[model samples]
Each structure stands twice: as C-alpha cells, then as structure tokens.
Target: MASPQPVDIPSSILIIGSGVFGLATVYSLCKNPLFKDTRITLVDRQPFPTPDGSSIDSSRIVRADYASPPYARLATLAQTHWRTTFAPSYYHETGLCITASGPEQKYVPSSLANVQALGTDRVEVLTSSDDIRRICGLEGGAPGSGNTGYVNWSSGWADAEGSMRWLRGEVEKLKRVEFVTATVSQLLIDHTTQTVSGARIKNNSSTSTTTLTADLTILAAGAWTPSLLDLRGIATATGQVLVYLPISATEQTALQSHPTLLNLSTGLFMIPPSNRLLKVARHGHGYTNPTTIPHPESPSGDAITVSLPYTHIDNPSQSVPLEGQRSTRTFLEQIHPSLATRPFAKSRICWYTDTRSGDFLISYHPQYKGLFVATGGAGHAFKFLPVIGDSIVECVLGRTPEDFKGKWEWPAERVPEESWEGDGSRGGPVGMVLSEEIAKTTSKL
Candidate 1:
C-alpha cells in the first residue's frame, strides 16, 4: 500500500458511499496507469474495518441472469474479471437456476429469447422439468405448478463484504487514494458558474462540518444517494428485505449437495451459505422512498412487517424488520417444506433506491456541471459492482459508455409502462408485461 502524500491531498475526484461501488471505483481508478497522477478521495459514514457498518456479506451467491442482454453481457464480463484477477476463493461458481411456474411462466421463454439474441454464452433455456430438477436439485413439484427453466453457468454468488474489504485494502495501498469518514450534507455549487465545486460534509461524530473541494464528484450513496443530490433533482425509492435462516442438519446436507437455486416459479431464490446456513428472499417487491422513513441509528431486532403499498426506506445501519422475516419464512415454508420447522437465524432490512423506469440512473445532472449522479440500481445491481465501478469512474472523468446513452433524458417520465409488480413467483403478470416490452425493444435492434 502506498502512503498518503501531501501532493495527494488535492484530489481530482471524490466518491461518496463506501460500499461495493465506491470501493471498487477507487480500486479501478488507482489501477489505471493513465490516471496514476490523479488523486481520489473516498468518503463514507463508517470507518474502515468497522463491523457495525453495512457491508455485503460474502457467503451469498452472485449471478448474471437478466431479461436484458446488456445486463447479461455486463455480468458475464464482471464474472470473467472476478475469476481471473479477483481471488478465486472470494467467489463460487455454483450455477444459477431461474425456475418459473403458473401462466406467467411464459416470461421465462421470452426472457431467455432476449438473452439468446444477445449471443452471449451466459444463458441457456431448459426445456424439461426433469432437467430443471437434475440441474437444480429440486424435488416434488406441486400440482398446477408451471415449470420453465433457464441456466447460466457464469452466474453464482461471491463474498460481497470480503470483496469490498480486499478492494479497500488494495486502494489504501495506492498513494493517491484517501478514505475520509464524513457524511456529506450537500454538494457545493458555484452559482456564478453553474457548476459543482465540492461538497459540504458533516463529520458523523463531531457534528462539525467542512467543505472539501474536488474537480469531480460521484454519488454512489446507495439508498441515501438522493438526499445528497438535492440540487440535481435526483430521488431514490427504497424497499428491500434480506432474510437469513438456519438449515436443519439434514437439510443443510441436502443444500450443500444441491446447486444454488432460483425458483422464479415461486418468486424466491436460495443460496447455500458457506457456513451451512441458507439465505433466501423475493425480488422486486419491497421498494420504498428513503426520505419518508426514519433512518435507524443501529440495526433493529424485530419481525418483518408487510403493509400494502410498502414504500419506505430505512437506514442501512438499522436491524431487520419482523414483517420481512415473516414473509420470508412463509415463502420458504411454501417453497421448501423441509426447512419450515427451522427458525430464522437472522434478518435484515435493506433498501434499493429505484428509478421509476426500472433502470439505473447514471449521468451528469442536466443543470449541474461537474456533478455526476449514479443511483436507482433497482434489485440487481450488487453483482455488477465491478462494472458499475468502472462506469462510475468513466462518468466522473467526463466519459460516458455507449450502453449508458440517453440515461439522463430530461423530464424523467414515469416508470416505463411495462414495469412489473412485486411477487415471489417468477412469472408474474408484471414480469410478463416487462417481457413484452423487452421483446419489442430487442426485435427492433
């Protein structure tokens, strides 16, 4: 690790948020030989090596299953990068199984077709229930259960926190990168020039604030991003639940032998933990607006709650809710009866800041110069942290990737009409609607 230097004090770039994205950005920038002269400052609310802060747990699976080719391609590239450069023990290639049931199961076919058209080797359509069972180690299908399958060898889970820790260490070794523990309150703008100049940050402990100047700023604050982008007119919607449960000794053995399973048919997926536990959850359902909900100072120990129109974001540092845990329990009971008797070992409530369009927002604010916004990851952003980090660096350096074109169109419209509703089952009505839209868009290409 290179020591911080006086010359490094004046950074050309500043990144807010220290989770997967921020740390990855620092690593990427520091590795670029062309940018060795550039100084980088990474700011976050939590200090390094702090267990209390929210970092991604590495035991879970990572994958590249998506209805869109761009995402699938990105995931494939990221997996490749992880396998070659990233430590092998940090990631596991358990394979991904996306199973679907019911009338909506047709979406699986459509999604597979879209991915196939992209000509990527990451996805393949499974045609038989027997194949699904054999590949995913699933048994006993319920009557009326419609089964459709998609398998991608490149998709699996990785140790998120472990990856972050490794990358943070690597970045800290760089002579140009600095880690600052401060909560940014606002982005300072030069009104006369109509450009962002720096940031107004409040030290978490002292309550004292300071202004740090930078040539460019990247907002990767996850759920809290919108709050700091007050001048950019950016907003975040959050509602995400992660449930962890202990597996019975027998079931644990079964899961260890089984592949990572994503039962789209049931709208839930399970990952066998490295420690003999199981992690499961539903996707696309628990979105909330962080501004409305109170940010808890610490993790909460409560049951998951499920109120209709569930749309409130909680602080990342807080505890899991009772409703989310219960819902996950019920989901597991229905999907895997063998695990029904086991109690929840732990649960945590997390938030996903979503854009109305169901796509990530990464672009310079239309009205603010030198200020870049990156938020609205929806539910599937974590696995792409490395790629997202690369993109963040590009955006901060005033370069936009071809895939991100038109990302910040003015007068942001309501979420695309094809947006899907939240459901545990894989092929729900909303997913089908989005599938149709995807088909139309892909056909044109």
Candidate 2:
C-alpha cells in the first residue's frame, strides 16, 4: 500500500478522542499560526478527561530517566513544560526514587549515565539502603537491603486529572476548538477514493447517530484505537492493574515528603500519597481481551473490534486481576513492610495500547488517506504530555522527528505477538484473555 498523502494544515480536522494525544494535538494546532483558521472538533465516548482514559489517572510519574536517548530528550523537554504550565497545583516536583535489585541493578547506573549524557546531573546516586531511605525519606531499605537506585531530583509527577483539565481550559480559549461527548462508532470512508471523510458518532445522551465530516481525522483514542482501526500487528490493548491504598492524615503527610518509587526491572512503581491514597502499579506483562464482531463486507466476515463504549468491558469499576493484586502486594511488602497488611482502598485494571516494540506509533495510515493515528502509549507516553503533540503535528506535516524515523511508523512485517505475562513457562499472552469467567473470579477476590 502506498503512503497516504500529507495535508500540512487541514481546514477542518475531526479528532475522535480527547485523551492526552488528542487534546495535545488540538493545543499544538491552535498555537500554530498556520492553523489559525482550522476548525477543530474533538469527540470522545465520555466528557473531557474521562475518568477511564489513560491520561486521567490520579497521578503519573513525570521523569526523564529513559534508557533510550530519544525518549530521554523528549521527557526532559516535557519536564520543563510541566514545571511551567501545571506546576504547584497539577504538577508536584516531589522527585522520583528509582531502585532495582538482582539483574535489574544495571538500570541504576545506566539511568544515571543517560541523565549525565544530557550534560546535567539532575540525579544523585545513593551509596546504600540507609542512604536511599535518608536521601528520599522512603520506608524502603537501601541497595544492600535489596535495591539500588538514584533520585532524579528534577522529576516528579503530575496530577493527571488536574493537568487534563488545565489542557482543556487552554484549548477552550481557542475559538476553533470544539468539544463533543459521543462514541465514534466507525470511520466514514470513501471506498472509491480510499479516503477517510470523518467519523460516524453516536451521541452519548441520545440514540441518534451523526456523521461528522472533516478534511482530516486523527485517531488518538488510546486503548480503544485497535477496536476502531485494524492495527493488528501494530498495536494491542493490554490491561495493567493498580491498587490504591488509603493512609491516615499523618501517614499521607510523611509519604508526601517522599518521592515516587520504582523498580525498573519489575515494572513495579509506587506513587506517593495523594489525598490519603498511595498507588502501586505494574508495567510488566498486561492482559488483553480477544474481541470480534461480524462484518459481512469484510473478506473474513468477522472484524476484530472491541465492544462499544469500550468502558462496558474495561473500566475503573472492573476488578483488578488476581495475579496483579498478588504481585503488587508482594512488592509493597518487600519495601514498605509496615504497610503490608493495610487494606487496599480501591483497585482496577488500567488498559494500555501497547506496541510490540515500546515506542509510540504516530503516522498517516498507509491504507487510508486523510486518516492519521497517534497512539501506542506502551504504558509510558503520559510523561511526554506537553511535547508529544508537536511530534504528531510534525508527523502530519510529513516531517517527523529524526528519532521517530522508523520507530513511529507501521512495521513492514507482522511483529511477533507479545504475552501479557512475562516470557516464561508461566502465564503468557494466551492465558491473558479477559473472559467472563476470569472477570468474575477476580471480582470475587
């Protein structure tokens, strides 16, 4: 298939998702002088900053400790934006304490080196577990105690919901940006021309469906991307679990003084208390749902798509996976032993649009002209909330960043499928399907 022709700046753009990527794109376009006359419309299944969207979490770590140089640079740039734009209220510069044990120990030195390569020593390596505790006021012991890591003083976390609200406010200031609450059912495609006109949306408050026409349509729908687009080998939806533990006022204060804790190799991360809630989530193998729908027009007669609203199946109300709960407990107990027995305040399985490779997939669809995609969070794009839109804008203009040359486009071959569970003899991707039986079992737990 030939690459879709580029549209430098479309007169009308219909964005079918209002999460991080969508909002950021709108904000970036509004700022560009070339798009001064562009009429932009953003539609989502729910209201702006929907609670279930990946970007609307309680809090997300905002650090630039990526082992990859491109991401390191992008994260550093985003860190600067977070500080200036959302600071004090939405962004907290509480720092991040990254630790690793066993074979994962290499991440510590490598992360420090990556930061140094940027010609800035924003991190300070701790000598021992005692130093780790003292330097960060964390309950976990030092490197000798089982983990070795450093503190990125310049990095912290952002109040995700607050940041989303702030972004929406900024976008609303633009006369060209329009927000709509509706579920995009399908893309309006011209079969003869092979060009996407816009989207077919179902109004959230009514049963009526409407066709929204535009010169261009960008899908930034996050986990729901695969359901809307046939991105089989390019991206998959993976479910990550997070448990929120409630603490007392005193405990919250003490924990607030600490930085975000992470065990890089284990995909285990800890967010300090926010409103008496401390959260722990895993970034490792996540789960997936094998969903399909009938499509008489398709050659296969069955199309791979998630159930509509996408929230009915995967939402905050859903229970966390059993294994996810177990792993989170084990890691927390290992570090903060005192809080080991504390009852969890709440828990849920958060979904991520994971690419086989960890980089984002942002480009024009090879099969559909005037259609673009900006997804592939891979569970880490939230940190780049500020500048990620610029990357997308560049992609739409046919001038992507040098680092994104091959990384952000569709792969030539079908990439090997990844397991939600680690690559071991244990639970693999095959067993990660979210069936009704599995959901019932986890909910009982």
Candidate 3:
C-alpha cells in the first residue's frame, strides 16, 4: 500500500488531549495565517490542566542536555523561548549537573560533547565526586551516587504547571479554538475508507457517546495514546516514580539556587525545590502495566494487550512500588544525607509514552487515513513546550524539520520489545512489571 501524503491541510482538525502538544499546536495554528480558515477543536478527558497528565507537574528540567544531536539542537532552540517571553517567570536558570557512576556513565560525556559543540561556554566537566558536590551543592558529597559528571549553567528547570497554564491562557486569548471537555472513548474510523474521521467521546462516565467528526484527527494523548491503539513494540506507556518531601524555609532557600542533579547510571534525579517541597525522582525505564482490552479499531471486537498508563485518575490511592521508593530513598541519602531520614510527604506514579528507540513517534498513521500521531515523549518532551507545536504543525504539512524527519517519523515495522536499543540515555532497572512490584509494596508512604 502506498503511504498517505500530507499534501493538503484539512478543513477541520480534531485534537485529543489538551496537554503540551495539544495546546502548543493550538497556539501555533492560531498564529499561522495558513490555518486562518481552518476550524480547530480540542477534546480531552479533563479540563485545561489535567491532574494526572505528565505535563502538569510542579517542575520539569529544561535543558539542551541529550545524547542525540537532533534533540540536543532542538532543545537548544526551545530554550530560547524558555528564557524569553514564554512564561519567563516560571523558568529558572539554576543549571543542571548530569552525572553517572555505572555503565550508563557513557551517556554523560556523549551528552556533554553535543552541548559543548553547541558553542556554550557554560559547560564545566566534573572529573570527581567532589566536583559534582561543589557544583550541585551537595554538602554531603555523594561519592556513591555519582562519580563523574558535568555542569551546564546554560541548562535549567521550569514550573511545568505554571507554564502550561500560561500557554493555555495564551491559546484561549486567540479565541480560535473550541475546547470541549470530554473523555474520548475511541477514534471514529470509517473502516471502508480507512480514514479516522474524529473521536467518539462522552462526559466522564456517561453511557451515551457522541461523535465529533473532522477532516483530520491528531492523537497527541501522551501516555494514554497506546490504550487507544494497537501499539505493542512501537510505543508503550511506562510509569515512573516520584517522591516529594517538605522542606523548611531555610532548607528551601539553601537548595533553591542549586543546580539539578541527575545520575544517568541509576536514572535518579533531583530538581531544585519550589513551594518548600523537594522532589526526588527517576528518569529510567519505568514499570510497564500490561492491560488487555478490545482493540480500538478491531471490527470483530477482538482483545489485545498493551502497556497503558494507570495513573491516579484511574486509581486515586495507587502509589509507587517498594522497589521504586527504596531506590529513590537511596538516591536522596546519597545526595543529601540529612534529608534521607525525613519522612516522605507524598509519592506518585508519573507516566511516559516511551518508544523502543526513545525517539518520538510523530507521524501520520501508516494504516489509517486522516490520522496523525504526535506522542512518545520518552520522558523528555516538557522542555520543548514552546516550539514543539510549530514543529508538529510542520510535520502535519509534510514538512518535518530536516533534523527530525527520521527521528520523529513512525517506524516502518514493529520489532520485539526486548530487542530494542533505546536512544542510549536510559539506565537502571528494566522489564519491571507494575503489578508484581506493587504487590511487593511494604511501605506506608
């Protein structure tokens, strides 16, 4: 079968999920004169700021720090918006210290080389644990957590919720979009034509469903995208762990200006504190929650299993597994020994729409017409919140940036999950089953 060409813009576009990608695209479309006559509609399960959405976090690292040149360059471009008018108050130039102590240490230097090549003089190479301690402000000196690392003053972190709220407000100010708050049950596919018209959505849990048809449909649902498709090895959802602890005013002041510390070897990272809350999290391959459900496009209503996101929205009381909690605690003890004994205030499972190679799965569905996919964040799309929409719009017009043409394009075929080699940035545990690990829970908080 011949591939579908993004030759012309659709008269109406239906976007599911109002997260970063959705809002960004809305903003870009409103600004672009080419889409002045286009009717744009956005539908999501929740209102503007999704509670369990990955983009609705307190803080997200904004850095041109990646092992891949394409992403590194793209991130550098996005940072320009971050430093300027794109919610400038929410972005902090606290810097980032990326370290490693295990075989995954290779990612540290490789990322360093890319960023340094970008011609930023703010790069400082850390050859010892003491070097990390000095720059990252780890008074306890974490010799065990990370041995070698580098600090990039050009890097920083952002208040994710604030930024998203700001972006949503900006998009609404244009008044060019119709935002509908509804839960999309399935894509409205015309099987005979092999075209995805739009989506069948309902309010919360109402049995009655309504269809919103359009000339084009873009699925930017983030981690929940796999649950709407038969993405096995192509793209899957993984749940990452996050543990937050309260800090005193003085403690917050001391750690507020410190650079974010990340250990590539273990995937443990600590971003600077905000609102007197300190967060310890991991960026590694997260736990997979395999679920069997009727395939969205199955005419016969056959069931298929896929790794889907099970967030607080699904189970409000669900917490991170014991293994994750223990790992995060160990990371905190290594970085800030004083904070290790402090009781954790809260913990949550953050989901990521991860791809096999860690490259974003952004492309028109090869099998379905009028359907474009824009997900597979791989735990990193938050930094590009500013400029990613323009890029996605370009891809929608069949003009993918030269740098991301192959990187963001959909895979020609699906390979077995175990045989996949990620973008070479992930580290720590692999093949963790969420249920098995949750069953081993032995912690109160």
Tell me, by lDDT, which candidate is best.
3
Taken over the whole model, the C-alpha lDDT of each candidate is 0.59, 0.76, 0.88
Q: Which wins on TM-score, candidate 2 or candidate 3?
A: 3
lDDT of 3 by residue, 132-232 (tens): 98887886666435888899999999999999999998998999999998988899888999889999988776778898899889999998997777778
Report the alpha-carbon TM-score of model 3 versus the true structure.
Answer: 0.97
Model 2: which ten-residue window has the lowest total lDDT? 420-429
Leading candidate by TM-score: 3
TM-score of structure candidate 1: 0.78
- For model 2 the TM-score comes to 0.90
Point out where model 1 deviates above 4 Å: 1-11, 49-55, 59-61, 103-107, 114-124, 127-131, 143-146, 231-235, 248-253, 287-323, 408-445
User: What's model 2's overall lDDT?
Assistant: 0.76
Q: What is the lDDT of residue 202 in candidate 3?
A: 84
Question: Residue 406's C-alpha lDDT in candidate 2?
Answer: 83
- For 1-445, candidate 2 gives per-residue lDDT tens digits of 2275756679899998888899899889888888888899998888766877888888998888777778889999998888785434788888887766554346567667888788766678765667666765656663323356788888889888888888888888776788888898888877678888998999878899998999999999998887677777678777777899988899888888678877665667788779889898876666767677644124345765542223423453666667677778877776787887788988877778877677788888887788888998888888888998888888888887998688888666655465322212111123366565356576786
Among all windows of 10 consecutive residues in model 1, the one with the lowest summed lDDT is 304-313
> How far is 214's C-alpha from truth in model 2 (Å)?
0.7
* Model 1 residue 224 distance off true place after TM-score fit, in angstroms: 0.4
